[model samples]
Target: MSYQTTETIQRLWDDFLRESLAEVPPEQRQQFAQQFEDRFSELLQNAANGGGDGFLDLVGFGDKGPVEFENLPYPYVQPDFDDSVVPSQLHAAAELYYIYQHERMKIFKVVDVLLKLFRLGKMRIQRGPGARALYLVEKWKPLRYGVRDRMIAYRRAFNYGSSKAPAGAVTNVNFHRQLVGLIVAVAQYFRDLQVSEVIRGGPMINQRPFGSSATVQRLGIDLRYALDRSTYGNIFALTMEVGHYLNSILKLLDAPDIKKAFDANTKWNVIEVVSNRYLGGTAEPSQRAKMAESGRRILKFVADNNFETSIDPHLFQTELRPIGPHAEAWLAAYRTTPEGQRFPGVPTALRSTRNRKSIPV
Candidate 1:
């Protein structure tokens, strides 16, 4: 079945056709018009049916976007990876990196909250309660210890990487494993911190009452000052560094499934080049240059930090979880009940421990 052309496309084709056949004699113009309409109709039908796959190649057009290419010197073909590239466990690695990104954000949030308290305390200097809170924050240096302890905890989680990176050729898989280790440390660090009551209490210096607009505005200024300090500033800077590293590594380790149909030999693809440039919306040449330079810096940062020595892998192997009253009761019940009745979908077959030849409660 033939597909109908949209009014916009039909108008565009008509204009193009009129210009191309402008020199035709008046008597032959009727025939030319009929032929052009038939061909244009067929082209639209083909495009609608199968993306004009056969027609696109014949016309020397590669559809990266709305842009069109005509009468190219060579036919476009997609690029493929060289044989040197191998399949790796990238899925797991991506997940780990994401977790690291999340934890880094959490750490930032914790600091921001602590900083807010300082701002609030400073505002309440006239009040006895505010003065005492402010004094504690100044003397104790909780913010310093809070950030330091978390960073140390995270570093310890990847004990394997901390010792030394194993010497040999580094592959994509190896890079992923090392990145996983780095992020694991970060995730574990935040998870441990979250459960600590002491850190949560004065986490930002000490909790402050959420006040009206006037108080909040004053606190906001205080927040700026707190962030200006070296300790909090360093934490913020490290967060950005880690975020940039993750972004670069993920882009470098890319394994695209659906490749673009563009000629590998072609140095310049106008459509792709323009699209990438306008990715964050159209910008001036200066902004485009800045964007390019920023990308280079991120790549350099990743190159310097990727798969570096920092954490021990052994630390991630074991995790601690609290078995509170509810958990203890559930385990006791599971142990007493028949295996079949213990849980709805749990398997009856048991895996034994050293002391007992039975499934864990």
Candidate 2:
């Protein structure tokens, strides 16, 4: 299969920007174009060098480079759906529930990084958009119910007695959409910081004059160097996987049987009902609101920093320290987990049956 290259993706982005900015005045449009171009070009270069933007580059959708996607293992498939054995609505809910778990894990991973950064006092944002954003991130902690408790709720729901499940065991109707939105919001926030680093010219370095013969030279600091590259790379790959799982849930939800399971007019309604009943726990309106507000503030900061004025790179710098062992363990577990490894159906032993069927010449 033909793979997409940085050049191709760049052209597509350019065309998209032109159409998107058509309504803006010429001067503003030009500025917008330039900003996007610079950020996108840097992203492309990074992805080509095997450092992806956490989503686009890891899944064979990035620029062609030394890392080849052609040899990647065959994609994992979910279990085959059987409406008779399991209600379509229940199946869809279960899938969404699984994906939600993964999403939560990804969020926790990012929060873990940020928390470490906070504890080390390495990030230097005294006040401004970065400061406010960092404050919100530090304060943001989603409640995590015990796995056993959640599993019990799942069992009750599958048994068609979801109403009897414990409080806070079921998800709201808007769970998938809301969860994905939050994940993307957080992802973009970090992405903005990543982009800023690239924009400021990677790894601050001090240079000496060619003829200076100085015995010792001052070295420039790279904020990112404090964290392990593998750690960040894992986070990016995991985020990309979350997106793939989300797409799968959408497909499952769109099935005709799943749609017909609910009395509501649309498939979305089906999702809402299934998720609320089968997935445990009432929605936290207050927490959601807080998260939304925080997201808005950070995103606004990103927009201003991207187009108006850049955030100071110094604010993110910290004394070099290794990430916490718990964070490392979490990432390690994520890499080794076999939760999503099941194939949808039986697999053939050989790549092609045609070879076996052919007569000897």
Candidate 3:
């Protein structure tokens, strides 16, 4: 039998073998290598079947790269339904829903990016176009609290204090909230459409009122509707409108606030604060050393995963801080003049990078 593998997958396999040998005892190395290959091969098969580039995506390797402004690929830029062409209403609607579902993860990414920038004080909520940004922030507030509780639970599980929670502990929480928020938004939009069917004897044309999690689970059922062209167009338009609003809010962020927020005295970067708690605490010397090692590993994990990898502490300094320059550029571009308010082009696909720049704090 023949097998196929990409260069990246081959590289990953080689790296895995090398690392495993160093970690596993000589006597157990063979057994561990066999098990690792079996599981990795399975993931590789899944990736290959899904039109994936390679198994690199299964890890965080796909997103590891230079920091730049995060932009979502606009899915409605369909070749089949271009400006000259007119797709059937039902066809367009169904396609839009499918596209939204397929790109749902990117929507979550957008929310996560917004939240992180907001927390860093790089982005501020303006009055007009900032409404969507504010709405998302407000919706995420309770979710953030829930995440903090989960983190506290995690700390207790590890016999660690709340202050000593591992670096990047809240990452999973942010991911969960963003995913749920996206699902709820779509679900609510569909529910409003259904409600309009009875009262007005037609589909809802506007999406302003349906941005909540109340009907999220019903999204699966709502996907079955045979909507008209106008309805699909309306939904497509709404998606673009929301994207534009997000972009506008991001561009209008306050750079001064971001600089202030990131100041060393005020901002407690995960790497520095966590390391100090473990490496510089009153624990036994051996325990402190172990804790510091753990902290380093945690920072590497977060950086590889492309989440909260911005601040490079003295222990783990690198150029992965992508937010500062991007934020500065955005602030520079924001304009009060109508002609200067052009939105940047949305990415057509996920951006890739060959290297990452780490900023020293």
Say which candidate scores most in lDDT: 2
lDDT of 2 by residue, 1-361 (tens): 1134544665688688878789887546545766776687566555544532323434546454334554322222322221112222322333324433433333323334434554676444345443444455456532233334334443333222133445544323333233233333333334444555445642222111111111100110110111111112122233244435345444434545434434545545544454455444223222333333333332222212211112122222211111112222222222232321121221233223213376679
Candidate 1 is scored at a TM of: 0.16
**Backbone clashes in model 2, listed as residue pairs:** 168-281, 169-280, 169-281, 170-279, 170-280, 170-281, 173-272
Model 3 lDDT tens row, 1-361: 0123344456678886897689877656656666777776666555445533223433335564322222211112122211222334333332333223212213223445545555565554434443344455556442322324432432322222344544543212232232223233443344554575556632323312222323332322222121221232234443344435434433423223332433433212322332343334221222223323332232222223222221122112122223223222222222211222342331322111112366479
- TM-score, prediction 3: 0.18
Candidate 1 per-residue lDDT over residues 196-311, each given as its tens digit: 43455653323321211222223222222221221221333344445454343223112121012122122123223323433332222322233223322322222222221211
Model 2 TM-score (2 dp): 0.22
Candidate 2 residues lying further than 4 Å off, grouped into runs, are: 1-231, 281-361
lDDT of 1: 0.33
How far is 269's C-alpha from truth in model 2 (Å)?
A: 2.1
Which ten-residue region of model 3 has the weakest summed lDDT? 68-77
**Which 10 consecutive residues of model 1 have the lowest summed lDDT?**
255-264
TM values, all candidates:
0.16, 0.22, 0.18
- Against the unseen true structure, what C-alpha lDDT does each candidate score? 0.33, 0.35, 0.34
| Runs off by more than 4 Å, candidate 1 | 1-125, 142-149, 158-361
- Candidate order by TM-score, highest to lowest? 2, 3, 1
